[model samples]
Each structure stands twice: as C-alpha cells, then as structure tokens.
Target: MALVAQFLVADRVAVAFAKREMASQIRSGALADLPCDTPPPTVSDVSIGGFPFLTQVLTGSFSDVGMTMTGLPTTGPRIERISAHVRGVHVPIFRLATGGDGTIRIDDMRAAVHMTYADLNAFLRTQPGRVHITPVDGGRRLEITATANLPLLGDQQVGGVTTFAVHDNKVTLVPSEISLSGLFNLTLPLGNLGSYVPQIPIPVGDLPFKLTVTNASTDATGLSLAATATNIEVSTADQKPCRPTGS
Candidate 1:
C-alpha cells in the first residue's frame, strides 16, 4: 500500500510540473505575440483536463486544456476576462519532461471575452464625442446616448435603443429607435440623425491564440465576444507565433 501511495504522489507531481511547463510556454510565446501596442495579458488557472495525465503524456495527446486570462488590452475597450479551451493538444511527453523544442498542435479551440459596462462607458467617454450605455429590458437591449457637437448647436444629446450585431470582426451597435431629449422628448427618423449620433463599433479581432470572432452578445455585466479557431500549430519557443496548421 505504501508503494502504491508513493506512485500516486509522484504521478500528481508530474502532472503539476507538466501543466506549469505548458503554461510557461504559453506565457512566453502566445502572450508575447500579442500586438506590441498593448501590454501582454496575464494568464491564470491553467489546467490539463482528463484523468491519468500520465497516459496522456505517453500518447502525446491531451484531451483538453483550458486557461483564463485577464486585462487583455485592445484597440478599443479593454477585455476584462478571456477564457479559452483547447481540444486535441499534441505535444510530446519527453519534450515536456526535458523542456526541449518541438511544435505543439491543437485541433481546435474556443474562447470567450468579456467587458464590463463601466469599462465600455469609460472607453466611450475617451472618444471624440460623448456617449454612454444603459441596459434595458434586463440587458437584452441597450440604451445608447451620444452628445454630438454640431457646428452651431453646441452640444446635442440624442439617445436610442440598440441591439448587438457582429460584423467584420466588430460588435456593432445597431440602434432601432432614435429620440431627441429635452424638457419634452421627441422621436426622430433614424436617417435624419446621421452624423448627429455616433455609431459605435467595439473591435474584437486580433486577440491572442489565433482565434477569430464568431459572435457577440450583451448581458447585465457587459459585452461578450465568442471566438473560435481550428488547426493551430505553434512552436515550443516562447516568443514564436501560432499559425494555422500549414502556415
């Protein structure tokens, strides 16, 4: 029984070491490969899923791997959280054990990013115009208000209700109804507003892990971006870029 216990303890130690090594590699490579303009994101909660990790080591194929990253800076709003999962990760056991150079292949991966309403509001306030977002109908729709500085009107605040739409790797604010606010609110034609209102597009592309934006939605907290990628191959080198299977 004592000998069996020793073996089990050693197995757990090996698993921990392997998971740490994988995470280190990711920190050095994928995180560094992020856009130079933004600070590198911090990674956490890295886990290698499936039991008997040793068996996976022997086969050089992991069933599942997941991690969470935070404070991912983007061109527009900062991403508060990003959780990613990879399936069919292939890396040699010996390579992990010896810290040798080799290529890591991932069959597919999915990732989700989140941004808070407060953060979105902060981002909007920094733009050329003034805009704020409020959730309506339990966050199913958004009430967006923008203050435009017209040539002679000084500043005019207009508001509208909009839903999220994913287009060209951006989350577009598609306003359904527009209204002008004063002592008495007046509903206006959407086309007439034109440049008087701002069309906000939250960019979600160019994130790490080579993932592409698939969809976007909003909730009580903030906006969520769903992304996916397939056939990823990255080198063991910490600073190398992950590429598609062939490229």
Candidate 2:
C-alpha cells in the first residue's frame, strides 16, 4: 500500500512537470510566425488528456492536449480567446520532464478564435460612423447602429441587420437592411445604400500554430473562427535544461 501511494504521488508530479514543459513549448513556438511587436497572447488552462499518464510517458505519445490562449492580436480586430486542441503529440518523456532537448511532433491541431462584441466595438470606433454591433437571433444576426452624416439629413442614427460570413481569411459583415431613425423612419435596401454603409472586415490570417481559417460562427458570447492544421513540429532543442526539483 505504501509503494502504491508513492507511485501515485510520483505520477502526479510527473504529469505536472510534463504540463509545465508543454506550456513553455507552446508559448515559445505557437506564435513564432507573428511579428515581433505583437503582444504575446496569454497561454493558460493547459491540460493533458488521458488516464494513467505514466503509460503515455512510457509510450512517448500524448493522445490529446488542450489549451486556451487569450488576447491574440490580429491585423484587424483582436482575438478575445483561442481554444486549441492538439492530438497525437509525440515527445521524449525524459526531455519533457527535465526540459531537455527533444523534438515535438503534433499529428493535428484544431483551434477556435473568438472575438467579443466589445473588441468589435473597439474596431468599429475607428471606422467612418463609429458603428456598434449587437448580436440578435442568439448572435446569428447582427444589429449595427451608427451615426451617419448625410447630404440633406446631416447626422442621423442609422441601423442595419447584418450576417457575418468568412471570406479570404476575414470575417465580412454582410448587411441585409438599413434603416434611418428620424422624425419619419426610412428603410433602405442594400443596393440603394451601396457604400453608404461600410462592410466591416476583420482579418484573421495571423492565427498562431500555422492554423488556417476554415469556417466561422457566432453565439451569445461572440464570433468564433475555426481553424485546423496537421503534421506540425516544434523543437525544444533551444530550450535551456531545467533542473529537477529536489525532494
């Protein structure tokens, strides 16, 4: 019984060490492609999935690993959150535990980038009319309000309904209807509005981990960009070796 307890404690310690090493690796290599000036995203909530982690260590293969990174900067709107799932990760257990040299191979990874309405508002504030976005239909549709200057009407509060779509690594706001709020309310068709209302595009091509945007959706929280990639490799060769905590 004492031996079993010792083994359990050792297992827990090993898992914690492995998790820390993995998090460091992710922080170093995840956004390597981004610009140096870009603020580093906060990496947290790292978990290694699977039971009896020692078995995985023996095999040097992790079945599933998940992590969350927040405040990812893009060329346009900032990404509020990024949920990443990695599968089939291979690494040397000794190197990972001791923070030594090794190569990490990931069979595949899927990431979801989330943008909150607050961040959307930040981007809109820089645009022509200082537009604001409100999600309707549980975020499936967007209600955008802006103060527009017109030829005869001067500055008036104009609003429209738009649905978001992904095109060319960007989230494009597609407005279907526009209405002017005044003494007499007037609704205009999209064709008539033309460029009167701007189509907002949030570029998302700079997501980390070499993941490419594939699809996008929205919910009550905000917009989410789904991305996926395969056969990614990262090296821990440059990492300074870590000393094991003495018991």
Best candidate, lDDT? 2
Pairs in steric clash, model 2: none
lDDT of 2 by residue, 1-247 (tens): 9999988988897788778767777776665666544556678999999988877867788899999988666777877888999999887767666746777788999998888888888887887777888988889778989876665777778888877777666677766788988776998886756566777677776677778888878898888889888998777654333355572
Candidate 1 lDDT tens digits, 1-247: 9987887887798688768766665555456456434445677898998977777766878899998888665778878988889898887657755857787788998998888999888888886557788997767888988875544657777787766778766677666667778744878767755566666777666677677887888888888889988898776655544565665
Which prediction has the highest TM-score against the true structure?
Answer: 1
Window of ten residues with lowest summed lDDT in model 1: 31-40
Given candidate 1, what's the lDDT at residue 95? 71
TM-score of each: 0.83, 0.81
Q: What is the C-alpha lDDT of each candidate?
A: 0.75, 0.78
Relative to the unseen true structure, what is the Cα RMSD of model 2? 5.6
Q: Please state the error at residue 43 of candidate 1 in Å.
A: 1.9
> Against the hidden true structure, what lDDT does model 2 obtain?
0.78
Which residue runs of candidate 2 sit more than 4 Å off their true CA positions? Answer: 1-4, 36-39, 96-102, 147-157, 236-247
* TM-score between candidate 2 and the true structure: 0.81
